[model samples]
Target chain A: MTHRVAVRPSGVELEVLDGEDVFTAAGRLGYRWPTVCGGKGTCRTCFVQVEEGAENCSPVGPLEREGIEALRRPVDGLTRLACRLRVEGPVTVTKRGVRRRVQE
Target chain B: MMDETSEPATARCPGPSVQDYLDQDSRPVPPALRYERNDYLGSEDIDTARFTSREWAEREMRQVWRRVWQFACLESEIPEVGDHEVYEIGDDSLIVVRTAPDEIRAYVNVCLHRGRKLRTGGGNVSEFRCSFHGFTWNLDGTMQTPPCAWDFPHVTPEKFALPEAQVATWRGFVFINMDPYAESFDSYRGTFDDYYIWPLENRYKSLHIAKVLPCNWKVAQDAFIESFHVIATHPQMLTWLADANSQYDVMADQPNWNRMINIQGAPSPHVADSVTEEDVLETFYDSRSFYSAAQGRDLVMQEGDELPAIPPGGTARQVLAARMREQLAATSQQDFSQTPDTELLDAINYLLFPNFNPWGGAKSNIIYRFRPNGLDPDSCTAEIIFMSSPKQPGETPPPAKIRWVPEDTLFADIPELGVLGPVFDQDCENLPYVQQGLKAMRKPGITLANYQESRIRHFNQTLDQWMSR
Candidate 1:
């Protein structure tokens, strides 16, 4: 029932139980992931690269879709919102550094 | 070439031609949404009376602020795991946290048990645990631990989840609203896309300066929108950037997204106007208006030498001239053209509706967020965050401390001015007194000036309209 989550650049990985949100599990493991809107998927701060097992995640919700639209990223195929993504089997997530010079 | 009256007999009629007359009459009446000049409340109304009373202040918060979106923090504040920052706005406190590698979450600062505040300031935390009873919730807001779980029967994690707030980020800035049914953040932004969408997204954070102000939030917010006050309220700012003939432009009016683009130059040397070329030249050379005289000394070159100014344009003179022209043009057109096609400086000031104001410039990106301090109406907390782009990722942050002299400190220098400085000192210093006056006043309300402070009037009018709705 354990699922794998991997972070990029830092390459930190953690395990979570099925049905656990990537945000919740990482937090329990003492790893920080950025989220505002409290994992409701309203703020795109919980965005991650679904390196593997994209099919294991849940479909994009309204809030995640809204965020993806704001980011001007395509939401049709692979990418999934981590807050909305339910752990199912093995999956890897990559964290990308913000491209802007000024961090919020 | 001829005598005044008699010359017209031989000369052209000098009257509008049929085509000219038709063109003049045919010109569409540019959107006749007349904003009432006197309908707004003034500083006198805000004096010691209204600002100090808790009940009056809470009513104002509900009528004016609760429905509007407020700037919470920057995405960079919680760039890594467990990084978090606390924001308080009008009796509400939200903790914005980086819960996962690419996740950020916000929750009400209160703990479910006994309603005590969970976290104080901000830091890295795997879980937010209530200090009162050792109840803990994971970053996602799910209950993880509770003392003596066996004692409480049928108590489930879902039953005691931490309350959450609506959060949205546009161009690196994060915003949150407590009202669940509030309109989407995009809708609230109105026409900000035309000016900020690109530059804000492209820009990086170089510096972060935060301060707390003591005045009612509106007063601090009002200090930013118009140049009318600069001449009197901010003498240093006036000496540095403003003039009598400075133009004003209302960028967007759907929800009072008004901004004044004041400049001291003409469009071109050939264009006819009262502002002299010398005045324009001086406007361009006056770097001391924005940067400190000490800072400008290094950038301003002698007569013919070349040097880079605080903003774009070649030398200090040309930079100032270009800035003036840009400001003047934008003011006249009611549009923003200050930002170039490709460069660092884009927006001068982004006055986000309600409570947030982001003043953008080449040297720094200063953001202001004003929130009510507590249940008390007369007092509000102003969080002034000063941000700058770092030369490199690991480069040192600017000096965290700012020096302020009590007598000599201008509104700009007081570290606590936004939080507790002379500016906040000036504003907050008067709020409590104003609140007391409101409670004691026997009459209905006060009046507002028509022209000098139109924005303030508009703000009150908007508040009335929203509250009525």
Candidate 2:
């Protein structure tokens, strides 16, 4: 089963395959997400806001919960570890810390 | 260099270097095994100007850096899929990533679209999306998407995969070769099959230090291949560093391997003064203290005000080994009972051609790597990785990021260096001075001691082979 994911601002529609996490689906579509620890759920650099259809995503795993809570800045409960969060239905995600044109 | 007034280069016990150590107390195969010298390398003169010449550095960059297998990063650094690290050599940058649970891949960090450097440092990425124009690539280097795909009619995903390099792993170190047709890792590291007998894959990097030094990479590397400088640069070590009695083995068959076995608990012959048993014990305590520091433990020595007498037949090496085993067992809570005494008591520094140095034995805990800084012949980055036996099986902690020390930052400022800080500080200080001295020298090149500096000579000879190619 496949679900649709809409990337905010860029207005790009992506097909998120069943069990495919939002972070990976976005990457599959060439929407680059910031990740320092890759998809290991260690670096937590891939945090993203599930602005719409939060219930459509899989429940947060332990690693994502710990990472989000440990974050220095307070984050909304809907913010999930993009690397660990798998999409279960259609959703919209707003990636934080991503800039279209930025210097490394 | 050993003084003319000192005794001959032979070890205290006779026979082949390996048999001599085995005869002592049934030790394992010594790091410095039976090895004959390559006469061709012995007579060749090394040009001192190579240290400061721009043309020579460029040639090395083209012929050596591009062609040789260089240490990219440790496998432990990127244990999970999508984990990557950027390794830059000369002007090229490579992104080493874990494509699967067990497989690692290397790709040129340049975006295939416009050739902009794709990544700078390291991080996890689902796919490599170039920040400039949003040209993205999957972890395996396949083009995932390109901005305005319909506008670029000529660009096809099949022909535009990110360029890749040859990657291989030895122990837990990930190595990359930029040359597409370079020789296999085994052929490149010929005699290294017997170089590390102990388990190297079991260890993980606990401390990662990278300091920019003002010297050619070779100059910085030469400072470490031999223990001759221990007397002058590390004066405190004169009491126990067997500088003159150390075994220097050169591999005639293998151009990429050499070893120096610096026996601990013995006095440097260059000191010319008789060392007391107390002095020897002090040196042992120093080593114990340092090892304890690495494990975040403080060792309290049992010695009193007066130095204890040496047990009738006991040598400093034996006494030190016994004490170290007990201390390590207590501090680390691990059974070292089966570990051999020789591995605990000796400083077995082994070098691979180009720039890979790993000290041998269970007690050995540090590895060093040197590389030219960008294109500058007068500057290089010296990386020191401190490793320890795993406290618990399969529980090795993740490695720390590379701590970059400034030009003036004291080694003591870095907690990870622990007790070895001063020794590293001494070497770091001497490299720049040596680089300056080379610049001032009028002679073709300085001479090397035949017996003690054999490894340095072998390294330079192997370097010339790669440079000539």
Error of 1 at B440 (Å): 9.7
lDDT of 1 by residue, A1-104 (tens): 78777667677777887878877777677766776445655445677777787777767755456557656788973566667777677777677642222344
Separate DockQ for every predicted complex = 0.02, 0.08
Alpha carbon lDDT of each predicted model: 0.54, 0.75
* DockQ, candidate no. 2: 0.08
The C-alpha stretches of model 2 lying farther than 4 A from their native spots are A1-104, B1-22, B26-40, B286-292, B296-309
Q: State candidate 1's TM-score.
A: 0.58
Judged by DockQ cut-offs, the docking class of candidate 1 is: incorrect
Model 2, residue B220: displacement in angstroms?
0.8
The root-mean-square deviation over C-alpha atoms between each candidate and the true structure, in angstroms, is 16.1, 7.6
State every prediction's TM-score relative to the real structure.
0.58, 0.79
Tens digits of per-residue lDDT for model 2, B1-469: 3345544544242323433443564344444343334332453446887798888888888989898888899999899998899999999899999999999999999988888887776777677767567677888789964668898888988989999989999988899999999999989898776756766787667778889999999888888888888878888888866776677777667888887777766677665267865677776566545333554222336545343356887776666666667767865667767666667767777787788888877653678999999989999999888767667756777776788888899776776566577788998889888899987888888787766777888888788888887
Worst 10 residues of 1 chain B by lDDT: B29-38
